[model samples]
Target: MSAILSPRPLIKENDVKATLLSPDFLRVSQPKTFRHSIDVYLKDSNATGNIYFARHFEWQGICRERWFFECVSADMLQSLGVFITKEAQQKYVSETFAFQKIDCEVNTFGVKHCSFSLLFRFFVGGELVAVGHQQIVFANKEKKIARLPDHILAKIREYEVEKGE
Candidate 1:
C-alpha cells in the first residue's frame, strides 16, 4: 500500500518535531500496564468492523482525564477549567476489534510551566494497537491560557514512569 493510503512511516529525523507519532515517543518496554483496562465496544467501532480513526483520539482524551483525576481532587479539577488540547498526533499500528480489553499506559513528556505532553499506548493481548499523543495546556472557558498550577505540576512529575522500568 502507498503511504497516502497506509500509515505513514515515522522517520527518526534530526529535525522532526516531537509528536506522539515520533520515534522518540514513549511506550512501556513491557506489554502490560496493569492499571485501568479500557473496553473496546461496538460504539467505538466503525461500519467496517474496525475502530474508527477518531476513536483513538477520544480514548487519548479519556486517558488524559483519568490521569488528571488521579493527580488532583474533583473540586480542584473544576477550578482548573478546561485543558486545551494544543496538539495531537496518532499512529495506528494495527486493527483492534470490539470487545477487547485494552491496556493503556500514560507517560508524561515536555513538562513546562503551562503545558505538558502525554503519550498513550493502547494494547490488546500484549500487542500494540495504537499510540496517541497530546500537547495539553491550561486554559479557562474563555480560552485564556494560564500557568500550570504547582500542585498539578508536582503530581505530573510523580506520575511519570520510566519506560523500561
Candidate 2:
C-alpha cells in the first residue's frame, strides 16, 4: 500500500481537542505485529466529569515477543501534569500498569511540522518490560494547545496492562 493511502492521517493532530469532547469510535492498532498504533482522548480537567480512555489488545505469538506501545508530546505532558496530581500519579501507578520511565525527544517531523517524540517504558517491579512511543506534530505552530489528542486514551488502556495480565 502507498503511504498516501495508509491510515496514518485518519486522525489529524489538530483534531485532538474535538475528538475528546465525544469520541464514539475506538480505533485499534494492528495486534501482535511489530508495527503498533494507539489513540487516546483527553477530557477537560476543570470540568466536573469523568472521561476515561481505554484500549483492548489482541495478544498473539510468543509470550515475550509481543509488546504494546504509546507516546505523547511534551506540551501534552505538561498540560496533563496540571491535572494529574501526585495522588493521581500514585493512583495511576498502583491501579494501572507499571510506568518505568518516559524518554522524550523534540524535532521537526517535516519541513512543515514540528514534533515531539515520547518513548514510554513499561515495567514490572524493578525490572524493565514493554515499550511504546508517540509522535505528536505541531501542524499549526501559531496555535496554542490547551487540550491534547485522544490517541493517548488508547495508550492508557495498554498502560493498565504493562504487567502480566
Candidate 3:
C-alpha cells in the first residue's frame, strides 16, 4: 500500500467527473483514442488462474507512458518535473484468462490548469473486461504544480473526441 495524492489542485477545478467516468465510450469506442496492448501471461495471473487485479493498474500505467512515447513528447515530459497520479479508479467487469491479449484504449478528459484525466478501457475479443480512470498532475523541481503546457495540451486535444460524439 502506497500513499495516495489527491484533492490538491493548482486552481479551482470544474465539474469533470461526468466526462471522465462516462461509460459512453464502452458502448461505442472513441474515434481518437490512443490504443495500446498487452499479452497476458501466467505470471500475470493469480492463484485463481485469473489475471491479478493489480495487473490492470500496471497495464494502465504502461499504456499511459506508451501514449506519451507515441503521441506526446518525452522531452516535453522531462521539462515538466515529477508526475503523480492524483487519483485512480477501476471497475473489474469479467474474468480475464491467461494468454488473452488486452487492448487498452487511452483518451484524455477533464484537462485543467495543472491536472487532467485519462480514461482506460480494456477489451478482449471486442468485449469490455475492465475500465479505469486516472487523474494526473506534474510538479516542478521546487514541488510546485505545473500547468498543462500548450504543446502538450494541443497534442492531447488532437486525440480528444468532441462532446456528444
Better of 2 and 3 by TM-score: 3
- What TM-score does candidate 2 reach? 0.22
User: 1-165 in candidate 3: lDDT tens per residue?
Assistant: 897777786444454555555687347644478988799999999877799999999999999889888888866477657668999999999989899999988888877768777888999999999988888887786778987678877787666653332
The numbered model that scores best in lDDT is 3
lDDT of 1 by residue, 1-165 (tens): 654554655576544556665655765443223245788889989786687888888888777777766654545455657778889999999998888888887877677888887878888999988877788888865778888778777776655544333
lDDT of 2 by residue, 28-146 (tens): 54322223322222331113332221211111111112232123233444434322111101111321221222121111111111333323343334343333333433322335433
What's the count of clashing pairs in each model shown? 0, 10, 0
Report residue 99 deviation for candidate 2 (angstroms).
Answer: 14
Off by over 4 Å in 3: 1-31, 161-165
What pairs collide in candidate 2? 39-151, 40-150, 40-151, 40-152, 40-153, 41-150, 41-153, 69-132, 70-132, 71-134
**What's the residue-level lDDT of 36 in candidate 1?**
54
Residue 21, model 1: Cα distance from true site in angstroms? 39
lDDT of 2: 0.29
Clashing pairs in 1: none
Off by over 4 Å in 1: 1-34, 140-142, 161-165
